[model samples]
Each structure stands twice: as structure tokens, then as C-alpha cells.
Target: MRSFFMPFAIYVLGLAVFAQGTSEFMLSGLVPDVADDLHISIPAAGWLTSAYAVGMVLGAPLVAMLSIRWPRRRALLIFLLTFLLAHVLGAMTSSFEVLLGTRIVAALANAGFLAVGLAAASAMVGSQAKGRATSVLLSGVTLACIAGVPLGAVLSEFWGWRSAFWAVAIVSVPAVIAILCAVPASAVDPNAPTARHELRALRTPRLAVTLLLGALVNGATFCTFTYLAPLVTDVAALSTNWVPVALALFGIGSFVGVTIGGRFADTKPLQLLTIGAIALLGGWLLFALTAANPITALALVFVQGTLSFAVGSTLIAQALYAATDAPTLAGGFATAAFNVGAAVGPVLGGIAIDAGLGYRSPLLVSAALVALALVSYSVARNAAHRSNHSRGRSPESF
Candidate 1:
């Protein structure tokens, strides 16, 4: 097996993830600037974010299935280059419609990059180390939240939103260069499963249940998280400066959780998932109860972030195991599931808020979703166990 230091290829993939993630997350901070510059309403500007999520939901499985026969390294490079070009077009576009289109294109490229990157990372190491490799690849998103997202926000604040897009394009240049140097041109699998096979894997009962569990877990987190700013301001009663501090704390917790989760992902995935969900459920309940206390609310925010990411890597590992026959496509499906949840979460939370349920109401909604996720996982795990027992085989973990 290759030593950890030899994974220059995975590091390059991480760079690609960071570059794409910066583009995805920076938009939230740049919404006001984008709206003002384009003379669009705030809600219209917000739709740009929605467009990116929609693209991701559609693009992940689409790209994975389309590129099933391509060399993983080549697919990674292609996606990175497309992402670079999309950001350049985004920076240059003046029309809101044009900008929205660019975001969708960029998001497609981002989805392709992530799906192929996971397959590449898993292939690089022994099966036992696949979980660790996944964590390293996914660390890019958390690291972006900690640094790249804030840097983009600052760039948008000082120069302009277009400058932030330009910055993403510029950073992508190094990522593309790194991948070119580090990622080898491996041979494509001529006997790779057809699109039909990939689709069939999705139809498997266990895989379908796991995907739904992923979606629910993600939705539970975002239900409250999508409205975090308002919750902090109106309920937590913190000043604007503290909002950034709170966000930083959440990022820090995520970084910690992913690292810890990676250590156990291979051997204790089911246990970790259950514990993480319980922690998250408790964390949200605490958050709802303590929103009036600024310090406690901020502390719970960090806890929630930790719990949110802790289960995430393990869930991806679970999905990969469940769909071993179609791992790459499974990764894409998992990405789509999470995005679907992310898209729906904010809408549900928004409805509650519009009904005058208050900012903390989102936390209640989040907790309910967490309960549903737990129930879903339990059902899936038990079904797998029963089927395995009937076949005279040991049951697999959830």
C-alpha cells in the first residue's frame, strides 16, 4: 500500500474541491453585491444559489453516468478546466441571467469534479483506507469554510463580487496545474458497467434507503443552518461581528469532527452514525432552548457543526459499501441526495418562519428531520440484517 505522504494525487483533488467549494459558498456572502450590481431584487439574487444547488442535484449522477467509461484522472482534469472557464465567464458577465447560467455550468463542473475525485481517491489506497481517503478529499469543503469562503467574502466586500469570481478562476489555475502533474493517466475500464447497471444499483432497496438516510441527515442540518444568520441576529442577539465569529466556530468544529470521524469510518461507521445523529439531535434541542443566551447559543453552534460533519463521512462510506457494484455512480447519487435535502430544507424552514414560528423554529424542524433519519437508518439496518441471516451470512453494519 502507498504511504500517506505519497497521496499527492489526493491533495490535488482536495485543491479542486476547495476551488469549487469557494465558488459555491462565496455566493452567499456576495448576494447583496450581486443584487445591487445587477439591479435585481434580493430574492432574485438568492435564486443564484438555488440554481447552483439544482445544477449539483442534476449534474452529479448525470456526469458520473456520462463519464463512467472515462479515465478517472482525465475526467477530473476536464471538470477542473470547465470549472475554471465557467468562473471566468461568470466574472465577465454583466447580465443577471448570464450570471445565473454561468453558476449552473460551474456547478455542473463542480459536481463532476467531486464525483470523479471520490472514485480516484478510493482507487489510490487499499480498501481499508478508503474511508480515510474520503475524509481527506472532503476536508476541502470544511477547509474552504474556514478560509476560502471568508477570503471570498472579504474580496467581495472590498473590491466586488466579480472580483471574487475572478479569484476563483485564478485559484483554479494552480489546481488544474497540480492535477496535471500529480494525477497519472490511468487506463479507462473498458468493461465498466453500463448506464443501465448504474441505474439498477439505484433501484436496490438497501441502496435506496441509504440514499434517503443521507438526504434526511443533510436536510436536518440545513433546516436550521440555512437561516443561521437571521437566527443569530434576531434570536441570539449578537452583533454583526459575532456572526462571523460564530461561523468560524462552526467551521472549526466541522474540521475537528471530520478528522475524528475519519479515524473510525472504516471500523465503526454504524456506531459513529448513530452517535453523531444523537449528538446532533441533542445539539439542536439545546440550541433552540438556549438561543436567548448568546454564549450558549454560540457553543451549541459549534457542537451542531461537529455532529453534522461527523456522520457525513461515515454515511458516504456506508453508501459506497451499499453500492459496491457502482461506487462512482453511488457517490454521485449521494451528492444529489444531499443537495436535494439542502434545497428542500431551506424552503421548509422558510415556510415555518413565514408562518411566524420565529427563527428558532427552524431548530425544531431540524430536530424532527433528525428523528426521521434515525428511524430510516434503523429500518434499513434491520432489513439488511434479516436478509443476511436468511442467507446464512453475517449481517453488515448500517
Candidate 2:
């Protein structure tokens, strides 16, 4: 019963994440349509995306704190319902302002759902399998990047942008039903950490660095990903049609990365991080230097995506492990940290481009970020080693 139910519940949570992540990422492809339909400029429509990121960053910790005492299943249900309603409202809205408001609301729901969902999924598995469980949950987001975003674009192209919103809301219905049936009432834990205790746990040095590492690594990925279209069409000299293909390839690589990396994350996290960071830095640098060559650019995009998520997923698991004392809020910390990177990466990349650094500049920016992440990892590892030695534990225990 435990075996059957655990995987089933985790997959159900992943399905919910798929629905939410589709809405989060599909906007990039639908932005032009959204602007035209609402009679807003493209730049204004782009704010819808930014608004979602802002909501996630602010809402994750806030909602996690507020719902700390709630049953995981109950909190998840509420968040999923809010998410569904936001999409419905968004689909019905004619005004850009109303649409923007709906995006924020949906994002808040997404943030809360993700935080709670991560905690729930992690709790379902043993310590050794936590990384694999995290990957399974996050695989939904990867699938969103691969299939959902493209499907949304196609739907918008045929039936209008609102149809995409409707599609998300529609698909989420099954997830809502599954949650009701699959998520056990036993998910509630009376011994769960209180908000104050969770807050104090955030002060842990290892956890702090882990969260920062997640942000840095994710920022690097997004900084390059955000500008992939320009890189493909302008720098690589590929046709505009090749953009989606490149994006899809990146998504595919990410899926592969997470699936493979998750297996080793719990047993060899430090090694995964060390190798992934170095490989990512080298990959990004090579991409920057060879982006004008179409074949090399496309290949490197896939490689970079693989390395990024391999490391990124492991960082998330590390955060959960490090925050073992704050089980309730660990997921929120991870969510907020990743979203912070999502918000900041593109801005810095845009700044570089505005300074005439060209399409390859973002790749360089990614490399630099990875370099910093590597330094952080080194410092953390050394500190952990010293602490372990002082406590008479073998360095291998770290």
C-alpha cells in the first residue's frame, strides 16, 4: 500500500505542477498574441510574465508561513483551486489590467502549490530517494517546457490566446480530482515544525548557501534560456522556425539531465554539484565562443540545458536535506530561491545586450554565474569538512 500510494501521490502532485508550470512558461510564446488582443504594447504584455515571477518570489514564503499549520492536502487543494479560478478569470478578462491581476493571483497559487507540493513529495520518500522524488515532481515543469509551451503557442495561433488559458484550466480539472482521491489524509503531521521554528531554521549556514547556490545556478540557466531565440535566429543564422526546435531540444536535454542526476543526488551530491558546475561553465563558454556556428550553437544549447538542470535539481534536493529541521518551509525556500533567479537572470542578460555585448553575451553571463556558484560550492565544502573534522566525523560523511 505504501509503495503503490507513494508513487501515485507524487505523480499526482507532478501533474498539478505540470498544469501550473505550463501556465507559467507558456506565456513567453503567447506574449505577442496577448499584447495584440488586449491592445497593449508588447513590452506591457511582457510585464505579465514579470508579474508572475514577482508573485512567486513574494508569495512562496508568505503562503508557506501562513499555511504552516494546515494539512498538506488541504493547503494543496486550496492552492490548486485558486490556480484554476485564476486561469478561468484570465480567460474571461478583456482588459490588460485584469489579465495582469489574474497572472499575479495565479502565480501566488503556483508558488504556494509548489512549496507545499515539494514538501509533500519529499515526505513521501526516504532520505536516499528524496532527490529522485524531487526530480519526478519537477519533471512536470520540464515537460511543460517541452510540450506545454509549444502546445499553448499552437492553440493561441489557432483559437486565440485565451484558448490557451482555457486549456490550462481544463487540463487542471483532472489534477484537482486526483488530488482529492490520491493524497492521503495522513499527509498531515501534528509534529511538523512551527512557523517560528521554520524561520529559525532559515539561519542555518549550509541551507543559506544551498539556496544561494540554487539561485545562482538557475539564474545562469535562465539568462541564457531567455535569449535563446535571438541566439538561434540571429547568431546561429537559423530560420525563425528553428527557434521552437532549439527550445524543445533544450527542454529534452533538461528532462534527461534531471532524470539521470536525481539518481546520484542523494548519494553523491557534492560530486554532482562539482562536476555539473564545471561542465556548465565550460559548456557556456564554448557556446559563447561558437554561437555563430549554427551546428555548434544548437548542440551547446542542449548540453548547457542538461548541465544546468542536473545541477539545479540536485541543489533543490540539497536545500531540502539541509533544511531537515524546517520541513514545512524548506520547499518554500527552494521555490523562492529559484524564482529569484528566474526574475533576475534575464534582466542582467538584457543589460549586457543593451551594452552592445550581442547575443553571445548572455552565455558569457551564464558562465560567470556558474563560476561564482563553483566558488560558493568550494567554500561550503571546505567549511563542512572542517566542521566534520572538529566533530570527529570522516570527511566522507559530508
Which candidate wins on lDDT? 2
Q: Candidates' lDDT values, in order?
A: 0.84, 0.89
lDDT of 2 by residue, 1-398 (tens): 22323479889999989889899999988999999888999999999999999999999999889888899899999999999999999999998998999999999899999988888888878766778888888889999999888999999999999999999999899999999999877554677789999999878888889999999999999999999999999999999989988999999999988886777787888888888899999999999989999999888888888889999999888888888877658889899999999888998999999999998899999999999989988988899899999999877443
| RMSD, every candidate, angstroms | 1.6, 1.9
Q: Indicate the residue-level lDDT of 377 in model 2.
A: 83
User: Model 2 residue 242 lDDT?
Assistant: 94
Worst 10 residues of 2 by lDDT: 1-10
lDDT of 1 by residue, 157-188 (tens): 89999999999999889988888888888886
| Candidate 2 segments exceeding 4 Å error | 1-6, 394-398
**Which ranges of candidate 1 are over 4 A from the true structure?**
1-6
